[model samples]
Target chain A: ETSAKVIDGKAVAKQIKDEIKIEVLKMKDAIGVVPGLAVILVGDRKDSATYVRNKKKACEAVGITSYEICLPEDSTEEDVLKHIADYNENPKVHGILIQLPLPRHMDEARILNAVSIDKDVDGFHPLNIGLLAKRDREPFFVSCTPKGCIELLHRYGITIKGKRAVIIGRSNIVGLPVSLLLQREDATITIVHSRTENPEEIVRQADIIVSAAGKANMVRGSWIKPGAVIIDVGINPIDDPESPRGYRLVGDVCYDEACKVASAITPVPGGVGPMTIAMLLSNTLDSAKRALKFE
Target chain B: ETSAKVIDGKAVAKQIKDEIKIEVLKMKDAIGVVPGLAVILVGDRKDSATYVRNKKKACEAVGITSYEICLPEDSTEEDVLKHIADYNENPKVHGILIQLPLPRHMDEARILNAVSIDKDVDGFHPLNIGLLAKRDREPFFVSCTPKGCIELLHRYGITIKGKRAVIIGRSNIVGLPVSLLLQREDATITIVHSRTENPEEIVRQADIIVSAAGKANMVRGSWIKPGAVIIDVGINPIDDPESPRGYRLVGDVCYDEACKVASAITPVPGGVGPMTIAMLLSNTLDSAKRALKFE
Candidate 1:
């Protein structure tokens, strides 16, 4: 049986960070300015804090200044919005990111809406999403995770144009935005969600498949078309007492089985996860360039 | 061979207008207020004028006040933006629509972005489009033509949930918005565009297909799935030298051929076209109720 080639997202992410570092240095030399990314984290969810810290570290590595605003778990929506407004006015801040799961007491939609469109590095704001939907307009920022997936495809020389691509989920952050990006790349796109019937059969027809359903090992080997490429975006945790964390991270696709049938695939731990931070740094650098009117 | 049932969009539009007229009357009686729709036409394109005239006539039929602003063909972008600003602030205006295909010199995106999201009856604003993309949040207005397509399916009692649906074209106006709406309705959605390969085979699998590609007779009978429901949104002008104007109106689907294979289908000129105007009136009424805080 022929084995699939593993697409190393971690290596590509490192390559991109290195490229961004050089650009940041050139910009600093040319304009005596450094790109700044301001992240507003409401609540102290261990996972959210870890993600924010990783983002800050990524900014520092890329030579961009990271501005961290840690709000208490019980912070008022107004408090969060005030910080976002301040970041919008601050010329030094090129991108404003509000970590997700902003306290259950706060309205997620309303709070995300408060972020200015120009500095919306998270790209959750409606205007950025709307511009993305309209292929004619270039959005100030593309959501990080999905943008990372596309960059992976581009860097790997995947021909998205005229391809039969199926996406297995429709979440705003990953599935929907990635579908939009693929469509813009001219792929015939199909989106399957919880309500889809015969999803396995539908998935089997794709030349390229992106599984983001957050269900561990939901896509088995038999569901894949031989020689097709797969990007598994789901980072699902399964109970495993053998692991240090009491659980092991798996993806929506059964990797061991998929690697045998697929032509190319992204591994769970080294796949989409690393690409997210890489794209965040890229968006921040791009935002600063646009704001500063530098090429 | 069984023939398909013709879904008469004109009769349905009239029924909806009548329903809206009754509501308009009730609002007038309860609050002594009438819904108002403002249309700004920048150029003298015959088609744009015709569309504006139809919108005005539809408004009058539903007892809504119609506000019309006609600027010269060479009107500056500032002229149109000034009118949009006026309508945005006008308390009487419940819905604001800017006729599309604005003069080439004017920036369409910038001008449309100026309309307030509250009164964006045309629903072209990015914020509204973004809101639609997020299934959890409902936009103040859905683009009229796409809303009309969904309304036809609802009124016909064609189940959308769990159905495999295919949409042709990806125009922000129709194809993209309708896909989002169908997904919201729980239909598994696929979008095919110009660069799609094996378009026929992909479309042939759909239980419901919406063709908005603007290519006359592009969807042939052989390409349809047996007993499928078809909505033809394309309004293409074909050169026929037939009875009047040396041209004729046709849809993306081959009407004579599709009627033979499909279970239900909408005819071109009378199908999706009339629904657009009806939806505009419905949206205007909805806006008034929302603004006035009436149930």
Candidate 2:
């Protein structure tokens, strides 16, 4: 079996982040200005806190100021709105990210919509979504997860125009927009979801595959084309007593098997996961640059 | 060779237009008000003029008040904006449509964006496009052409859930949004284009096929599933000495070849074409209803 070349999402993402850092330093030195990101942490979930902390560290590493707001899990809906309102009005904050899975009591939709589109660096704003779909043009801010997936393909010199591409998982955050993005680039795209039957056959036929099915090993070597580039977005936890957490994170693709058939594939831990944070920073830098008319 | 079912686009469109007329009368009598559409016709292309005239007559047939603005071929950008501004503030106008294919010197994108979203009956507004993509939850008004194709399928009770559906073509105006609307209703969709190396093989696998390739006889009946539902959105003009215009209209799929193989199908001129205009009116009514908070 021929072992496939692993697409180094980690290294590529690091390179991008490093480039952003240099540009940010130049902006501060030349114009006495630095990009700022405001993160609204709505609850005490360990995952959300970790993301907030990492984002702040990323901001500091890049010379961009980071504002972190850690809210109680019991905070009311209005309590969250107040923070969004403040960020919207603040000139210093160029980007705003509200950690997801807000408490069930609060309306996630309404609060997310409250962030000014200009500061919606996270790109969950409806206005950005609209702009992205209109005329198949590049949206000011695209949802980070989808953007990251597409960037990996683009940097690898993969062509989208008129290519047969199949995407699994149809969630708004990943599948739908990515499909639209690919279409904008004029790729022939097919979207299969939970409702899809014989998804294996569909995947096997595509020249490229983007798997976000969250089910460990749902895609295997048999499902891939010999020269296909595969991007696995699923991070599923399965039982593995050998690991300290009593479980291990694996992507939707069975990496060991996929590596033999796929021309190139992304790894589980170091793949798309790291790119998400990097894209968030990129979007913030983009917002800053657009606002300052630097680009 | 098995003959294909002839899907009648004209009859379907006529029925839809009649339905709109009835609905318009009901709306008018109920609130002592009628739906209104403002159309800006730029330049004097014969085809565009005919489309505008048809739309005006359709509006009158349905109790909708039609407002026409015929600008000269050399109208400046400011001139177009002025018309948009007039429609934007007009309380009587519920929808605005600026006919496409403006003169070479005009910027269509800028003009399209000028219409207020509430009055953007054509559903080309960036805000509306984003709303359609976000979570596929609350779409403002889906793009007219795609929305029309879906409405015909829905009204006819063609089940798409868990079905193997393949869509040929990916234009923003038709293929992309139609596929999204289908997915929202739980259909598994695959988009195939000319670039697809094995379109025939892919189409054979689909239980439902939507052909908008804009090519004559691109989808052969032999490629269709035994009982697939076919929706043809292609409107290709082929040269024929038999016709007075020295041309004849045909769909992307071969009609004679498709009808026998497919359980159901849509015809070229009478099928999905009429629904395009009907949905435009429907969207206009939707625009007014949402604006007036009529539930």
Candidate 3:
């Protein structure tokens, strides 16, 4: 029997960036404008900083301008709000992203909501989500991670229409939004979570499975049906003494075992992670085009 | 084999209304305030009128003040918008409901969005829907019909957590919202639609099933898993020569056959229909309490 093909999300993301770079060049030559993305990061958390820096690099590679605002950990919510208000009014800033996990004192929801819907490239705002849920309405943006999941499917030409797709988790950011997108594409969708009884049995029946439960190795080879396509979104740290960090990153699905049974599967670290940044840049480009009326 | 037990929605609604009456009486005694509901009905469609009238009677029975506005079918969208704006600013109007299926010439989304989120009892606004989707935030109100479906499940003390639920539609009104609600309650949720292949096979795996496809008898006994609880939200009129109206109401489920396989089920006319109005009153009561700073 042939083992499952590994879906190279890292390569797909690079291809997308290259495609976007060509468009950015054309737009620059035609209108002398480049897409602008503003990232507001609160505090000095290492992870958030690394994420922001990586986003900046991605933006630059695509020929888009990147703006960063680093706020003090003790900064008042109003201080963050003022910066968001400034970006919303700035015509140059086509996309605005507020790095998540703000300090406890800050109201993350209020700050995120303050960003203009047109400039909300992160797609966390309710208006965009609501529009995304509806069939007729068009959302200004879709959340990055979920958009990346769908993009991987499209890039690989994996058929979603009329398939039985199971989503593991119901978080607003990934599981919920992705389910909406999948259903819109004509896939029958099921969401299984911690409270779901017999999750393994339910999952074993899916033609396609997206695991975002944030649990490590929750889905094993035995839980997968032969020929099923798997998109593993969970990034969990498991104890690995041999590794310098004392822990290693893993996905919700057991990748080693899944590859033997599944038709195609995405690997942790190199898979969904890279796609998120690619989709962010993609959304920024769309926002710039929409604002400039050049699309 | 024992047949399924019928869930009496009319009785449950009366029970809820009686409970609301007690709360209203206590509020009136303590603060001299009563919940007020304002309904805007456009056109002379018999169904819309009947719905509006039923709401009025429900309000009266529960000791809530009722207000109605009827407009001609030819009324411009602005004419309705102005009324909604007036109600939004009125301190006494705790709940504003614009009867659905408005005249074809009017803008439904624009008119509904015009109402203040505080008084939007119908919960059609995207903001509320977005908030509902998020686990951390509470929506001001849930759409009535879906809310009613959950209420029936709760009233019957049927545990939703960890159960596999199959929803047989994805319409914005009933199927979608209820799926979210079920997920929040910790039930594994699956949504099957027109494009779903082998719908019956997928549905047979559910422990709890909600049918809102608007297709008469789409779910037969063979589609049900033994001991499954069914909530039928579809209301279709079919030719019945024996009936005086020439057409009789039936749900998406084949009632006769379902009773044999299901553990418990709700009847068509008296099941989901009565619960919608009941939940409307419940939401209006909650709005009044929130506005009055009473919980």
Cα RMSD, each candidate: 1.3, 2.1, 1.6
What residue pairs clash in candidate 1, if any at all?
A: none
* Per-residue lDDT of model 2, residues B5-102, tens digit only: 55566776777778777777777777877788999999989999999998998788777889999999999989999989998999889999999888
Candidate 2 residue spans exceeding 4 A from truth: A159-162, B1-5
Residue range B23-107, candidate 3, lDDT tens digits: 9999899999999999999999999999899899999999999999999999999999989888888888999999989888877
Q: In model 1 chain B, where is the ten-residue run with the lowest total lDDT? A: B239-248
What CAPRI-style quality would you assign to candidate 1?
high
DockQ result, candidate 2: 0.65
Candidates sorted on lDDT, descending: 1, 3, 2
* Cα lDDT for residue B190, candidate 1: 93
Per-candidate TM-score against the hidden true structure = 0.98, 0.95, 0.97
Q: What is the TM-score (0 to 1) of chain A in model 2?
A: 0.97
Looking at model 1 chain A, report the run of 10 residues with the lowest lDDT sum. A122-131
Listed for each candidate, the true contacts retained, as a fraction, are: 0.78, 0.84, 0.72
